[model samples]
Target: MSRQMEKTPAFLTVVLYVLGFSLLMEWIKPLSQLTETGNFNVFIVFIGMAFFLYAVKAPRWIGIILKGVFILFSIHSLYFGESFFQLTWVIKLCEHVWQNTGLLFSDKLDSLSNEFRSLLFFVLLWLITYLLRYWMLVKRNMLLFFIMTVIYVCILDTFTRYDGSKAIVHSMAIGLILLGILFFQKIKEEGPFLSFPAHWVKWLIPFSIFVSAVLVFGYEMPKSKAILPDPGPFINSILASDRLNGPRGLEGLDMGLRENDTRLGGPFIGDNQVVFEAKVDSDQYWKVETKDTYTGKGWTSEDSKGNSFYTTGEMIWKLEEQGKDTSYGGQKSAFLIYQHPMPYLAYPYGIQSISSGLPNNFVLNDQTEKITPYESDTTHPTIVQYGINYVVPEYQKKELESTTAEGSKNEEDPKYLELPKSLPARVKKLAAQITKGDKNWYDKAVDIESYLQSGQFTYDKKNVAIPGKNQDYVDQFLFITKRGYCDNFSTSMVVLLRAAGVPARWVKGYAPGNYTNSTSDGTRTYQITNNDAHSWPEVWFPKDGWIPFEPTKGFFGQTIVHENVQGSLAEKEQKPLAPIQPKKPLKPQKDLLDNGSNAKIKAPSQSNMQKISSFVKNHKTSMIISVIFFAIVCLFLFLYRKKWMPFILIWLYRKKSGTETFAKAYLLLLKQLDQYGIKRKENQTLREYAVYVDSYFETGTMMMLTKQYEKYLYKGAEDLGDWKEYSELWENLIRKTAG
Candidate 1:
């Protein structure tokens, strides 16, 4: 606290300030949660580093202490990395890279073998090593330089709204450069780099930086952007919630889908969405009807709009008690979060009752059990609830067992028997040919599914040459050309059956998602993808209500039996998966969000995130090795500082002292040089060195010494200056040789 202590240089004060600021900035905005603002905070890291560099540079005495701090912080930063999840999320990123990379990038994604996480640790190690060596000798003195840079960058990135603090930490390199400029003057022969003119040599680092930035940013952005599809469509949909469905709370998101037609107009891409996740209780083939009759590419519903049976308080439970539940079934209450308005909520087949989550204005036709979204204005995140009776076979079997065969409901409806005007004769003949003896409706539907899928048809997304592109897609799908995907197959079958007087309606929804092992919970989870999109049909049975009969062979037929498929399809068709994988299984952690509605049970929670991360930090051997390697490098430099002076000379010549080489030589040259005022051109040869030496000295004495220098030392190594003693001798030789 004395005057002497206070006068211990501004650098030390700066370094302390830098440390305080780094801690303060870290404290003010702890890099914990990675929300949008937090992610932008990463940009401020540069400014924090700058402050740290300034503080370290502010004091030249605590080189060892500062180095230790840097190492400690770097290690700590790595452990606290996920806290900065805006930057890196190793596990999540890895899984995504593993799953979708092949889909986004071409051979680049496929060719790279998936390496384990340990390889990532090696990468981190290499990065730290490179950063250390790179900044080791950078000249960074003018604090103004960094301050100006930080201000400019903050202003520029403000448009990104990433947060200005990011600019602060990133610009810390200015501090490092200033420190190197002020203190770390020693350098060495970088390469044949000495052969280049000094101006060109000085530009090397900046030039390399420019080249690297161009290749990485300019070229990379365009290429990577081209590889990925625009997320604009999906993003816009999320933003358009206000116009799509009026004020449905988030919970009603799931139940409003079937009511989508009545939705308020907005930019909505419906077909591409994964609307419903249908998983049946029994493994029996789950079917949905999407087409009652086929026009061209789409199907029309043959069922008429019956009386509105959906009174707000009328429970479906009361009716199912009187009527029959269709399939072998059991159920739990359906809890749907309807993000936006849609039309129908498909309960797993044999839904005994509808208790909650249906729309307020929805008019559910009594006979069809259909709910329709009738309004036009919109909002989002509608949360709805549904409590359906399980209607297990234990109770429903009596109804199904005693029921008579399903007579054709289509007989009463003219719309069901109406075929598209453009129906082909051959298709009609083929349909009649196939129906030769199959009077039973189930047998008839099965016959059609088999005939279409039995190598006679193929799945193709490409446009097919169907006659009458606007009408009767069935005739084209049947006899003329059978190569079609699910839409075509189901369309053809549904229309054909309806034309033959069997009641059917077009059903639009995703096929059952493939089951996967749950991570948090040990229950079965389904991985639904947009690829499972399809349109199928449901036919009305006499007392049974409805049954799903997918007429498409490529999709529905192949997915009918588990034994008939492999991998994901097998799991989807055959049975719910037995849980296998556990996320972070090593860390005993349980999610508190298990709301019991899912039927999944989560593992128990144990260590906090920080505690679990100790695995990397506690690697004693690696830490020891890093410390030893760093210390060993320092030791080698200490031992060889003298021998390496020549390399150091080359390195230092580019700094402020490089321009004023006389600073070091001035003191040592005393015993050697009689004259004081003298200088040398950076490009001067030995002869030129001697001549420039005569410029500021008494001409004759210095001139004579310079003349001899061309004769004695013109060849190669003589121009090099190593020890301060050698520099003094060179200066004296110039003076005395000239004198």
Candidate 2:
């Protein structure tokens, strides 16, 4: 029957369901991008454990309420958690000591706290389950059991605020001591350990095994070890040009210019300017763009698809005669110093010969650039290209003014023209207004740039979703509400320049200003965050090349209060946009963070020093437990006492021998009555004890029973009856006590 109970489908069903649920979440990760929290995942495990434990013992209400409380906590935590500290209690229990340790838990503390909070909350609930099961459900002596639970306070205090091992040991010692005391109270003249299988006692073994099995399966206990450190930023994966496919598959577009247009920066935020350090043989402009006009967001030289992620590497070669053997591997190549990153895919600048680590499938682009398939996230080794360097040539502001003379007409650039269905009429109207009556496309371009920098607008950072059905977002930015950030400002700039007969294009790149600190490796690194995202307009500078225009208002946000400067165009040009007023609140603030016992951070700090000091001041519970434990063990030896005593003669010499003997006689009387089924549990004099002894015996025979107890226990007769005599006396006493 026990074996059948052990193999019962009820317990196994719970385990299978929990394992199945966890596996389902694990399997769905790749497709759904769903990430599970430690608390959420562990709650499932805890539920199964609680259910199994409850089922084995058949304590329905305790288990159900425990599960219900966990459910309440889980619901409160799941959608409401904003800070990292939120969790259920079971996690708190697992990490109580770990968190107090402080050194290893610093970085991931918030996540740890959250999971721990869940674990501890549930663990407490489970503890309650045990308490309710044992107390109310099992119908034990709840008051005595509660008195026993006082020892667990010592155990709990040590685990959370003191040494974990010490807590377990102290609790163990107290429990063993209590067991010895209880066993003493239970022993009989018939010999104590001979009880037959009652229904209640038979249930204990399987229930104990069930709890041990729950602990052993480990079916994901909220352990402390799963806490992990943050890995670096996410990187995309795409292969190289030497790997048979040109990055973005640009092999078909062999205009030679198509090779240099693939992305080469490290990590990108959508489309932004990613600048790489460039070195070359002589000073030259590293031209990412060799065209006069752009028709779309991307470069329009050739059309080929490319993976957004690819590995990166660089090579240097001497720009000597084309037929010469490169110095790399007996080929006459430039002695380059590459220090960038590996499998060098593409460099922003031109190179000469192969110097360092270069993956295969790379071909020289006009002996100037490295041609490889585009990869978004390749660990492109940092390498030095010693062939050529690029620097913009100095220009006079007045020299380019002649391009926009009065009555001039523009020859439409084919690549610059686009009439996408995506563009709206409001876009054209805004473009027409910005470029009104300018002599040529150049003046119109300059005029629009001036308008964008003006204070006639506001910048709205809160993303305006679906700017009405008929209008594209860019069109709405220019016409509907001239208020927006870079996406709005740049898109307007592009349309106006194109509409006014100027060859224009859009390019995503970095702006000049950034707060950066140098790394230990002497590399300049920027702590670029999500807030640093930006976009702007890039215009062709005719003979000099493309020049960048930051059309977005520079001082869109600032603390100093100021007003927009209005006057003649040139005067306003000299004036910057108004600063934001300090009084005008920019963003909403929330005061949701909690502190103290109400804190969502789960286990608040209960350091050992504090506990030790508090205990030192008065460890009442620990001291009481210590006293109880020691007293019981002492009783074990002190029953005889001389064996455990060091100076027994001294103790015996000072103490009143008769007085001690008399007190012991009373204790023996209480024990005899307890064994004979009549004793004052709390308080009774010898006379009251003799009267109570009459209850379990016949009134006529009660005198004999009392006489026997007094003779053996108080008069020092040493004649307590054996079982045969005691049985006869007990039968007569039962008759008398019936009255």
Candidate 3:
């Protein structure tokens, strides 16, 4: 008898049903897009019916038949039915899976149709439901069921991005179901039959309270740092070799582009896979590497050399020489890499030192401030984690302008100023025209930057035009195609500055992503993703080092703002350039003869909606908190209306009625009647109201109370029935109406 009871515990069956239902609800989201007219309610109903049938002790054969039927129904509804039962539907699905199986390992998994994806999800759901039911009914392992259920809930919470309050409610429901299962297990362990376990109630109440309190107050728990240990050398070797082929098999890793690639033409679409997390005090461009050599086609660093450094548990690569003096404040930043391993490390402009448990074979290029590992060191690499001490330089425009432009010239090689001989003369002419009147190199660079960022140019990621063979890239972009992405804009600025005799290099890295959270140790964490891949021009100042400039319209640049330079320096710079402006805007060159195909170009501006979206993104955390608080308040009012409404009505009535005790009592009675769905309308007289109540209760209590109140209110009669009697009638009426 005991063995039989284990096979079919009622409590276990109920828990299984509830768990399956919850999982089904979760799958509704992924499946909704696949169904016709976006109506997935039929599938939900079918799933609920299956659970209900199983809970009622359906025969094994019947359950098996029903499961097969449901699978067929799902397949038909998602694919074949849409095709009117064509024989080719199954073949099409098979072909799709065969062709796109490779995409599963890349970020292109979303390329599959929603219907096919939903069919796959349906199979997964069916299997999970079967396993869960078998575990409870056949294996009779309650502990295993509990553990698996908890794991499933955790995965759902992590991946689904459900809001806080909804997650809490779901968690609380699961907890209650688990508690019920535990109680049933306890009863089965004892005897055949037993009395209610009244003694356990005392402990259960406090446990429930403790759990509730934790759920409410601990919603924003500190997120655990994503620190998975390296999967050893063999696996890292496979990953390293695989990444060279493409980002096909490495979806989440930073596998899209290499740091020093020689070509940069493609669609600017990004998967936005998060690559790493940084803990810092303020926001700054996290620079990974810089390119000094521009080969007319693309940027490269083929001839660059670096100082090799070996790690002895903690490696430190100083940004400057030991005796060098600087006027910049320093801060510490730590980076935690998540996706694929890369040779370069992201740090701020002026890094002082790096400390990490890194491999002993890495090189630091002081010129570019880039760190890269040896070819052999990255075999089977895991996530790279490190910290850096970096300086945030403060600049004074007067000092930078006064400094000589040739202060620290690398006379041996001036690769930054190198340009292809085939570069169009119009490029240099335009640069000269823009900065003709500038007195200093700083002013010239700024003027060029302002020209690019002005409304005359636009940023386009999708429709970027490529230059024809033997055609200069910057010339085509500047003189012909005025619309392009970050590379086009940044490269243009670099070439223009170099033409103007200012040292500028192309720098590429990620833009700072959403500010996620902060740690108790005062370290703020940010999430950086693949979509944040960006490029900007960095100009060298005499004593200020490399200063980044933003020439792209939609993107914000972190250039140091000079407060004092605007007053005197601006007047001096503007006076000379004022006359250079054309009275009538020159018509843009329509036929550049680069590609021999004319394409209409329009400069895009940041729309008002985009500006508002940017503002919301910057303040997303505060907005989410405010919305959650408002939802909680609304839920509280809705759930406990009975407990609070009476007090609210009384307070409101008292404010209106100063000292009319009888009138106040009548008003409170009307409010109670409204609560019971017996409201008196505006046109109903006191006698009519009493008659309506008498029809339901078959009592004159309402009539008696109404008559006395009307007599006292309308006739100014002080000698009405005792106030105590009227109060008693009001209480009796309320009690009767409630029943």
- Candidate with maximal lDDT: 3
Candidate 3 wrong stretches, greater than 4 Å: 1-241, 244-256, 304-306, 310-326, 358-361, 366-368, 374-383, 404-412, 561-739
- What is the C-alpha lDDT profile of model 2 across 377-487, one tens digit per residue? 452222223222111122223333435634333343455545455666666777788777766544676688888888876665432322432345555555566676665
Among all windows of 10 consecutive residues in model 3, the one with the lowest summed lDDT is 575-584
Against the hidden true structure, what lDDT does model 1 obtain?
0.43
Question: How accurate locally is residue 58 in candidate 2, as Cα lDDT from 0 to 100?
Answer: 52
Residue-wise lDDT of candidate 3 within 169-189, one digit each (tens)?
A: 564556555555555555555
Q: C-alpha displacement of 124 in model 3, angstroms?
A: 37
What lDDT tens digits, residue by residue, belong to model 1 across residues 1-739?
A: 2332243346544653453344334323422221111122333453454445544444534543654444334433433344533545556446655655565456443234323222333344334432332333232224444455555555433322124454355445434434433332222222343344574457557755754564456434643334544333334334334334443322223121232221111111122333333222222222222334445444434346554544333443343333243323333322232222334454444344444322344445543444543333452223223333333322232332333235333333445456666666666677667766766665555566567668877666433443331334565566656666665666667666665555556565556557644434433434333345455666555555545666676564322211221333213343422222213222111352355565343433434432333433367479679899999999998765544444444345334233125334433333233233344433455456545655645354344434433333454334433334234444434334233
lDDT of 3: 0.62
Where does model 1 exceed 4 Å of error? Answer: 1-236, 239-243, 246-297, 301-314, 317-331, 338-343, 355-362, 366-369, 373-387, 392-414, 463-471, 499-501, 517-523, 527-530, 556-739
- Better candidate number, 1 or 2, judged by lDDT: 1
Candidate 3: give the clashing pairs. 236-380, 237-380, 253-339, 253-340, 254-340
The true-versus-predicted C-alpha distance at residue 203 of model 3, in Å, is 70
Compare candidates 2 and 3 on TM-score and give the better one. Answer: 3
Candidate 2 deviant stretches above 4 angstroms: 1-229, 232-388, 405-412, 456-469, 481-484, 512-535, 541-543, 555-739
The lDDT of each candidate is 0.43, 0.40, 0.62
Ranking by TM-score: 3, 1, 2
